[model samples]
Target chain A: MKNILFFTGRELTVEEMQEPIPDLHHFAVQPGVSDEPKCQRCGNETNFSSHPCARCGKECLYCRNCIKMGKISSCTTLYRWTGPEPDVPKAAGILHWSGTLSPGQKTASDNVLQAIQQQKEHTVWAVAGAGKTEVLFAGIATALSEGRRVCIAAPRSDVVRELAPRLQNVFPNTPPAALYGGSPDRHTYSPLVISTTHQLFRYTAAFDVMIVDEVDAFPYTFDHSLQYAVQKARKTESALIYLTATPEPSWREDIQSGKRDATLIPARYHRQPLPVPSMKWCGNWKKSIVPPAVLEWVKTKEKALLFYPHIETMEKALATLKAIDSRIESVHAADPLRKEKVAAMRRGEVPVLLTTTILERGVTFPGVDVAVVGAEDRVFTESALVQIAGRAGRSADCPTGEILFFHYGKTTAMVQSIEQINEMNKLGRQKGLLDT
Target chain B: MNRCLLCENGTEVDSWRAFFGAKAPPLCEVCTASFNRLSGPCCHVCSRSLEEDGECTDCQSWRKSIFHSNVSLFHYNEAMQDVIAQFKYRGDYVLASIFAEKIRTEAKKAACDLICPVPLAPSRLAERRFNQSEALIVCAGLTAAPLLGRHESEKQSKKSRAERMNAVQTFYPTGEATGKSVLVIDDIYTTGATMRLVADALADAGAASVKSITIARSGS
Candidate 1:
């Protein structure tokens, strides 16, 4: 027999499966669920096909909605164990981190624990570089000590990769398994799992605690299936914790309606303000390479990043800028040499580096000034602009850096990003977290 | 769990028996509907949709080699091209599984004792980490016997038809064959040159007969 492809908590087989019904308690679930090929797992209806199914040798309807995750059809049967539970080990020292949380982090961490205990929803409205991951460590440790299963899901693979090792380091006793598309840790039966949201489709009511980091990031916020995947992966009465640098407006409404209790961490871990962006109207930045203001800004800065909306324009600008300085290089979404370019920029060998929104989030270049060539472009949303600005002032050694937004005209996103940064600054100062 | 591989959307779609039966589709209705099937009058040898009538001149040379008839499921259109590219190049294993049931269904007609998929060169295998045809076989609920191996050579995609046909004879039968019907599998039936070479080698190795099945057929 082939080894069962057990992901999260769901058992899947490429072939038809049927186990003899053991004499046990069979509780009634949603009635009329298996009828009409409805996929109760994702709450989607079944799709009919005119072509004969190669497997069943009949014209059948299957759930195309969740098919990316092995298909769930009308005939697909799912079983769960409702037998007596075995005693779980209340493991001590699951978390062995030596670092201590700051006063703000401690407060937020306490709220996260409270939310997990109550099995309620909570959001950490932390700004960029606020040590959001650290805030969840206390809650995660508490859940693990109670013998509860926990999952930390992110939308992007890079974030999942970065987080898994950190989590495993903190929870040394329990080796946390990471799940991505081609993840080799698929078969590891661990209580703690760090996976991308897409991998959550294979799970069904498995996690007692589900923490989704970067909830507002791309693919997660925009993709409904991912949101549904998270819901399906968690137990009915489980705590749903969302950690994000920028929480959408719906989260605020949920908090207002008492659907959620949120802990807002506006200040960075270093207690410094996010660099506010200054806008300049440089007409048609596509034709202009190294504009006067941008040139002046680059000259004074030890290292800087020039963000363009399109790769074509960036290549043109990079070609023109190379004449001024041979150290200038550009990286885009598909640039094969992106890693080397970024590394060069970080080492200050590349005085000016051009990039796209691909480097908007989760990248930190200490004290490097940022300049956006096309701030008015739709590619630079309010969230992206704030994250680009966030790349500045990330290091405590240089907690203040310049961020310039050069565009043909100021778009609402640019204005909003600056406004959002200022608003967070005001909130940070009001809470006495920021130095005067 | 993921955005549709073909269309990057996450819209809800209905479940089909195929959706739930075995290997599920990683695509949406709109994307799946665009699968340009091999419909119209087909060439007997290559299974390509012939513009006029019966087997074209390409298969006339088959009498000299251990060539036989071939069947392809879909026409190599732009949409199918993208799907195959993602499966072969990008290493989307899920996409490869989506065709398993179809290939298995096709392989059933052959009723061969042993199934074999065209092998990748050592250099290509090191880079791709998989042979796409073998993955399809895995999805079809069968293990293909490792029968053939290839020498380090230029990729079929990079070479023209003439270049591919006249290119070095890379494939050689690696296993013994005695009175067993053999069906060769591959992702695409491009020039028939590689398949002909494999067929000739298989025949020389004492196979009863040789035939081929492919997921897509290039336009003649």
Candidate 2:
């Protein structure tokens, strides 16, 4: 029973003094030194502390509108207001940012930002861990500052949860609300909302800007209804941006043929070369135990996420691994405590985590590695395999990593994934985005 | 041109709308109403609007149909057929929402416990990357459980009616909805064969009752 605290924002306590912690009466905002703090809602500057709001308060500094609407309970101060409203960066005044754009993030961010500003549509194709989220931070801030409702929708709840903190960090002054399964703040009204794509059905023309992450991820990629939801949720003149690591063949053709404007971010943030996962054929891979080379590699690595094609195989593999070393554990979709298992891996509590494709994207672990069993299996399509490989080599602290593919035979998909990685590397190098 | 299902020939029309010209052969408001009207009668079991009797002979015998009830929006003619074809073959996923809105108007009177879509076997699903029927249900503001008929079988297109009827018993339900009524959905109702098999399977799985909701019913 260890504390499971996650980093939602740059530890605000360290960065800003007197960051207001939420309270029942009023949220803690940066209370200025005038011996009196003004209520942003009521416009009352004095005699509002520990007493009912003078103008219309049921509770101390609570607004009449908030009290009438009964939404007063859930309104937590999203950010610590640091200075006068105009002193803080507004939408247009924020400084233009142009740095060494990691090849993968460059064109995608620029094209998407332009599309949003011009009220057009654009698609972004990049490999996983290509820093897709980080690239859009500036553009998202721009949209929010302009008073546009912005939304970033992912296909998976786990991904939505993973992205919330990263966004919270970059936009510390503008706390972004994360919406997903069972989240307390899911219904919280925020100008910017990060949610699972399925949640888009609840809105219509609700956002002036929409960025759909993992456009090619299941079940959104495969589910047409959800795709329609993404389109239906946007305003008439709103910009729609699609971001995907593995754009399907049709989308690729659309980009190349100039029917759709697309930009590619072909490199990861760390700039360390993506590991080339070699296909190791162990004939009758299912029946055979972990190959000697692969086993030895796993033993040598301090920690790893061993991906099996199926849960049954993973259970068998886990039992076998535990027999060798009791520290090994397996995880799959049906496991109720999958989060706990993943957290254990993050905390270095588990040496190896055997799982299905559920951990393929979004989750990142520093100093950890990956190896796939039955890599040529039906589940290991090019996209799935590529995403699994991308899980490695994400953390800047441990950029160089390994991906071992244990297969019965070299399927076309297995070769294609490796080729795609190599192709991206070539593109990255050509763009001079590769690490020297 | 395809024998003009709505209007037999131009001589039969008194007046024609400009949209329906020579090749299309106007339905001549009168003939159009006669065909479009569902007020006359319908099958007691299937609820398919019939031209005469309240119950079509198809529902009189269980031997003729395994489906407990079947309901369709229209007699699959050129227009309805084209719309459905566009949705399936053309990747017009948006049509699902449009179709759903129409079905909602028609579904306001009738009721069922749950709306379940015909499950596409895993292989077909992988190839198409989606279940068209499921998409339609989603558009209709309905949730589709999609859990039925685990095993794969020969494509319904390749089998004869009797073969299809024989194959129907294996539709097998997972009993996810044991006591609740089910409103099964499909793109089209042809010969009522597939719907019958699904209904029988649902009953076997202990569904209180089963009814069908289809976009088009083929006019054989």
Candidate 3:
């Protein structure tokens, strides 16, 4: 029965299944990747290749794009449990969070709850550090009370990791299954699931309420396969809520034109404005010594975060910065000690941590001044710059901090990031959500 | 807008290479560097890395080895293991193209009259959809002479070293192996048990000489 529950909402191959079932539905694995080729799993259409298949004894086409998940060859069969759906019990006291939400978060949270009840698509365009995760708690609790499955998916694994404990703590009665590439709870069956967007490829019509956080983040925004997976993971008549600090330009236009329904939270939970980044010209910071302004900021003895465009530049800068202060360290995506470094910084051990755009979002340090060494780099998009600035002024005790953009030349993204912050501040003030 | 097949990163195609109508390299420089090329002193029989120019311990124990020698391009290191897993177990058929140029060079160097891929059992072939060795040979733009057939047996990965070495011969020659130099191609040469059995079958079929080329050679 437990095995049956595990396969209830999943489409798996025979080799992937551990137990044998009495009756199961079968579908073509490749499913016409040749004539009008399209991948059933990731919805990839362009990248397809054919190979001599031993099962069919002919050249069969397969989708190369989603081959990482497991090759779905033309002759293979995909199995699914077509019996009755798993019966999930409604739990009492699903949400145990005692913290109060700000007025902006309340409005957005109410909108999310309403969308779930109506089974409609909605967007929560909340500012960073605006208690975005808290807004989803109310909606998730409602969905759980009705015995409906709910999933909160994010583009990056870091976001999923950050949200897992918080969701687990609040939902004390119903433990959530945190899913990623190497998650231990991959086989767990739970009403509430927190997973990376890429993990949804194994699920089909699994969740009744699918909440996609950080929807505009990279790899999810640029990759169509992830977008298709999100759509396929949820039931046909399900609530889809998109949560983002910075929505894309096209989405923003739709919101403005009233074509898309959205709730905007313009202020942080602390009721303080997002720290605007001030531009500074640091001449040839790459080829020359460390900038004088950065050195001066280091002299202040306050904890800070310095961002560079590339890992090479960051490592080079780390050499000079470490000479000045022995405790300074740098981290990148591939650094094996990334977790230890980040944990040390959170414990107030590392004074200045140099990093790449991997830390642009989903990280917070109280009362730390932030600086972008190469703000004009193409990697620093308008959304990225805004998220980097949001890293400051997070904690209520330290709701104001300095943000500096030290660049050789300012790009349009830099200017737009500043303008977007100011625009949000103005809106917060108009809505009486920010302190005068 | 060519992308590396392994890393999916955008690969830079030089104008000169594109001007000569050469196919874009399947891997980028970073991905290419991860594969440790087999070099230095190696076993003359199995191509395993050795301290000096001599036969490895496994080759020394062979009582009646029929194959002349085995040539491998890369070490079966962690990176090569990952590549083989994705290409074979995962059925990413296009990934066979990554070894095309290297296999071509090795095959030419072997200079055998016929190139034969170690065959897969009928049931195993039906399950995996394609024979990895056959795909490797075909992708390298070489004709794969289906000169051998294999009987159903337990997977090599599932068996222990002793079990694999002592297993009965499974391969039987099927094509014209009489009086012709045959070169057997396979994806990996682990323990050399499978290759030995394959070579024995070819030799029994009256082949002039049997040589082998593998993409990777395991340390064992």
What's the best-to-worst order under TM-score?
A: 3, 1, 2
TM-score of chain A of each: 0.87, 0.76, 0.96
| Candidate 2 runs further than 4 Å off | A1-106, A289-293, B1-220
* Cα RMSD for candidates in order: 10.6, 21.4, 3.0
Give the lDDT of residue A110 in candidate 3. Answer: 95
- Model 1, span A81-139: residue lDDT tens: 34433333577326778897866688899999999999988888788878889998888
lDDT of 2 by residue, B1-220 (tens): 2222233334243237533663333234434444332334777666566776576765665574335677777777766665576555433444465456657765554587777788777776543335678777877887777547646877886778677655645577775777877888778876676777787777776777777778777644
Q: Which portions of model 1 miss their true places by more than 4 Å?
A: A1-8, A15-37, A40-50, A63-88, A253-259, A289-292, A299-301, A336-344, A347-349, B1-5, B8-82, B85-187, B190-220
Candidate 3 Cα misplacement greater than 4 A, ranges: A25-35, A295-302, B9-20, B28-30, B33-64, B75-79, B151-176, B190-194, B217-220
lDDT of 3 by residue, A1-436 (tens): 7777777677776666766554444332334243566766667888877887887878898878777767766655566666777766767326898999999999999999999999999999999889899999899999999888899999988888888888889988888889988888888888888899888987888889999999899889988899888999999999999999999999999998999999999999999998889999988887754688777776675588998989988888888888888999999999999999999999999999989988889999999889999788899989999999999999999998989998889899999999999999999999999995
Residue A144 CA displacement from its true place in model 3, Å: 1.7
Candidate 2 TM-score, true structure as reference: 0.53
Candidate 3 clashing pairs, residues 3+ apart or interchain: none
lDDT winner between 1 and 2, please give it.
Answer: 1
Model 2, residue A38: distance off in Å is: 50
Among all windows of 10 consecutive residues in model 2 chain B, the one with the lowest summed lDDT is B1-10
Model 1 error, position A284 (Å):
0.9
TM-score preference between candidates 1 and 2, better one:
1
